[model samples]
Target: MAVADTRHDDTVTCMAARLLRDAPEEFALLGTSMGGYVALEVIRQAPRRVRALALVSTSARADTPEQVASRDRQSRLVEAGEFDSLVDAAFRGLVAEQHEKDLALLDIWRAMARTVGAAGFLGQQRAVVGRADARELLSTITCPTVVIHGADDRLIPIEMGAECAAAIPGAEYVVIEDAGHFLFREQPKATASAVADFLGRVDTSH
Candidate 1:
């Protein structure tokens, strides 16, 4: 993915369509945080093409007013050349207590922020804040789905994963303890195992 903002594909639906225009006829989807939103949109757009889904530390609900305001404030700070506070705020809920002080992990996050820069951040903020509620999209998704969440995720909350699993028929749910919003990174082995198992069980013979 470009990793930059939607880059003119502002809406989730539009971005999903963009990916499908040249994507494989069928593929697995593993979405983390905002990516979960995009993946749901993709399912909505083309359920037939998605062989499986792995939703990680994300929600299907619309942004709360407080969340929108907070994102806007953070965007402003980025515009004003003050990104440290924003990063600090985001990082606090991103990892377990032990990994919070890990320089390597912190560096990876910092590098991503710097790579996206101010413009991409603003675009993403707009896309997220304006995104739709995907709760209703769950029932329509027929692909093999696994909902994974950090047991101690501060950003998306653990219950959100259960809610998604409950909404999506036949969706398996897993929790990674000692992880936070950045669960896949914090517990890569477990995360990969879950993903691999799900893919292996998929009925691709059709």
Candidate 2:
């Protein structure tokens, strides 16, 4: 699978969307969180190219004023060379309450944060702050789509994922119990099962 580069560009969403120009003529698209925003942008920019879609723990609405301020604060923290502090602060919101002390999951998050670096994180924050509201675009989607959300997500609530699914005709809505924003990491087997089932159906239909 080809992963799009979300670093180095201040317009991270647009940059990642542009990368789809190089993707196969048609392919399934799966995205989580900020990547989901990028996926919606991809749908806007090239609707005909997507064969199927899976959006995990993401929202179709644009960032709220409070969210924008939070991103700005995170950017400032990175600018002040407090990247670890920023990551630490965000850790609680990334997982279920029971998984708050899951060292293995935290380690994975920390490693990903280090790989993304301060600059990359800052760019992504900026991009998220400026992303478009994709609610209207959902109804236009004709491809098979699935919306997966953590039942206990503290980040984007499950209601938002349900809204996305409701807007898209024939879209499937899945809620993973005992999970939070990082449901894929918290409940990998269930999350993967849902995705595998969706993809399996998509393949069979074609």
Candidate 3:
């Protein structure tokens, strides 16, 4: 059970490989956001080691030029000591338009940003912006793959998750309605239930 911060996929891949080398018999990957990108990379690097995979609020494509530019702008702002503004912008992009006015959601987003901090956020943005397309790799995934996305996600649309599911044969795709990019925070129970049910099916099969 490892949680990787937003860093180069190689770092996470190396860590996963090392863990598998030490304990090849027991290893699974579960990741969200940029971590989900790492999980996909790990599977590509060491498919035999990853018993199962769960990707939440993620995409199989590289960042678009516009997105990359946006991340760079945000990174520059963070470097300029405008952490609060960066956090605010991030929160605005993560939630739906309707939820933007919800004080509770805003607080939760702020808390999440505080935990990650400016440096962490920039680091993650860098990694995400530098990621490669994982579509080709998805076809080779042998283990049970679960993709969860919020129907109302403003960051990565639900169609992206559906595309991933379509590419990965037998993969399970779950979309939680009324939830935005931060599904775990906005709809924890539904997200948890979907994951549990997916893992349960995998457990039974294995």
TM-scores for all predictions: 0.91, 0.96, 0.88
Candidate number achieving the greatest TM-score relative to the actual structure? 2
Q: Residue by residue across 1-206, what tens digits does model 3's lDDT show?
A: 45554432234455445545554464667878776777887787778777778889988888889988987888889899999987877787797667787789889888978988876777667667767788899898988889999999989988888888899978988888988898898888999999888878775222
Q: Which stretches of model 1 miss by more than 4 angstroms?
A: 1-8
lDDT order of candidates, top first: 2, 1, 3
| 114-192 per-residue lDDT for model 1 (tens digits) | 8776677777778889899999989988889999998888889888999999999999998888788887778889887
C-alpha lDDT of residue 10 in model 2: 71
- Top of the candidates by lDDT: 2
Give the clash total for candidate 3: 0
Residue pairs with backbone atoms closer than 3 Å in model 3 (clashes): none
Clash numbers, per candidate: 0, 0, 0
Error of 1 at 173 (Å): 0.5
Candidate 1 lDDT score relative to the true structure: 0.82
TM-score of 3: 0.88
